[model samples]
Target: MDRDMSVEEHLGELRRRIIWVLATFVIMLALGLWLAKGAFDYLQSIPPAADLPLHAFSPWSGVRVYMQFGFILAAAGTMPVVLYQVWAFFKEGLLEREREATIRYIPLSILLFLVGLAFAYFVVFKMALYFTTTVNRKMMLEETYGITEYFSFMLNILLPVSLLFELPVVIMFLTRLRIVTPRRLQRMRKYAYFALVFIGTVITPPDLISDLIVAIPLIVLYEISVFLSGAVDRKIRASEARGSLAR
Candidate 1:
């Protein structure tokens, strides 16, 4: 009966957190729509895109792109709030020291996400776009890009890179929770590299330069994750040693 009651309480808490995240997302969506026009214009002013002319293939294309931009922006804005809620929901089950350490991850995760987004937008995305456009120009093809297609490509590259940037933090968290260890990560390094390389190939343009540009960062992120996991393991071992000495 007690276990059943605890499960019910956890479910209820989860439902509440979901509701809060949804509400926040909805509110931000409205604000995002209002601001999306300026944001779109600013993005267009950037290189690669700046030289190209974007078109609306259909009457609804503009509206659809606006909504897409709004959705992405709103989701990005609400991510921190949602992450915090998720952390809080599971926090009570953690030890005092663990709770203190893990709580700091909320902000770190958000920062890493933003860094990824920026890197994708400023570097990988730009290079890919430029490469494609240059090829088209060289082939004597007129470049008429649809707004919808343009944004779709951007999101495809941006979202994955941003999420991939969280690898270190996620690995560290799992290490802290004893779900994964540095040794395990080290053992899996070659497989992880293959997976990351595959992901980079999928996300970037089909060219060696683009693939290498994207894959290198992902590989670096994985290495960083391993290093962070090692740090967490050392800390855990030190804590255990202290506790044993005290006893």
Candidate 2:
């Protein structure tokens, strides 16, 4: 992270940041592989998974699953570094107030992301898995789940929901930057609902109950985002009023 520079210097800076990000990713991936065993155990001990053992159909299935888990862990762990790099890259273009605002909310974004992960795993994932399994049983179908498939299904749900949890922070940031306002969010509400519901449908099991279980929280997140945006918009207006009076 550095100040404004000549064109060549800026290119060098960009390359240096890229190297740092790649290095972080490699380190995190290694650490993730080491921790994946514990994660595997924990997942197996959980409710839906605990009910039935997962099998590997292919010779490379175990390796693939471990790698996927490691990749996910690495991706999650590297998020802060990624955000820092992004902020650093554009820091020179941002006002002091914008830089400060961006820095202040990064940690909140990370916290919300972690909360989303937990919510997806504990609630949405469970509901979807239970529904799918119940359907198979109702149809009198044999239930043999591959480890890879089970986890792939899981990652599909976990990542999106976790990202949705960032809605409020994203709205607050956009509002602070004057790129988004409460009125815009309100006007866009119905379209956003359609998109969120569509996403919820795509990610969850193809069932109304599962879709609602996933979509309802997402809808709530949007509402909370609108509320937060309104609050930030109000503060901005008040600050501008005060500054004008001072002038």
Candidate 3:
């Protein structure tokens, strides 16, 4: 498995992994749909949304939102399997220690994703929603919201934050593979902060506080990524030195 693979062999392996991932996704999708109603009810019961009325402009809007929820649930459920498949696909090319280290990231990646979702939902999202609603109240605008639009906005905020939270894990993995190093990340700090600030502004309302709230965590995460990458680099170098000495 460590040796070079022919094109056909590679394709066959890829096909097998794809099949496994797809099968898992399908099962998860079904489970998601079955649980969607309860989950939707719980969401509506949350304090921010408790009194907010959701109108379905069209008859299909409710169904669409239900399906959207299903998709979200399915995606979350399938993420670990997908990550494992990805790691397995590339693992044959890795040294024994590298393989072991990378495999541990799958669960950690999933945990970080959940943390991101919670942060967005509880803190960032609540603040943004309150700000907008308060403005609407001040302007004397009726606060009618479409069910589809509401869910869409929620997903837009939740999904990206969760995915972006994987940055540290991704950087650490790439560091192990030698595709990137701490030195490169350190050199790119200013540019990275600018990019993250832009992303924060794009995702958040035009309020400076909201922008900083999102941007600051991202900057911190990037710094954490740099630190983790440096640690991994040191470990790799130490391991290599040990191997050379033993030889």
lDDT of each: 0.88, 0.88, 0.91
Q: Which candidate number has the best lDDT?
A: 3
Segments of candidate 3 deviating more than 4 angstroms: none
Write one digit per residue (lDDT tens) for candidate 3, span 39-64: 99999998677878989999999999
TM-score per candidate, chains pooled: 0.93, 0.88, 0.96
Comparison by lDDT, 2 against 3, better one = 3
Candidate 1 lDDT over 1-247, as tens digits, reads 1133477788888898999999999999999998999999999898767877899999999999988889988998899888788778767766678789988998999889989999999988887788788899999998889988998888888888899899988998889879999999999999999999999888777888889998999999999999999998998899899889999
Tens digits of lDDT, candidate 2, 29-143? 9999999989889888978788988999999999999999898889888889987887788777665666786787789999999999999999888888887888999999999
The alpha-carbon lDDT assigned to residue 111 of candidate 2 equals: 95
Judge candidate 1 at residue 55 and give its lDDT: 93
lDDT score at residue 208, model 1, on the 0-100 scale: 89
Best by TM-score: 3
Measured with C-alpha atoms, the lDDT of residue 181 in candidate 2 is 93
Cα lDDT, model 1, residue 86: 73
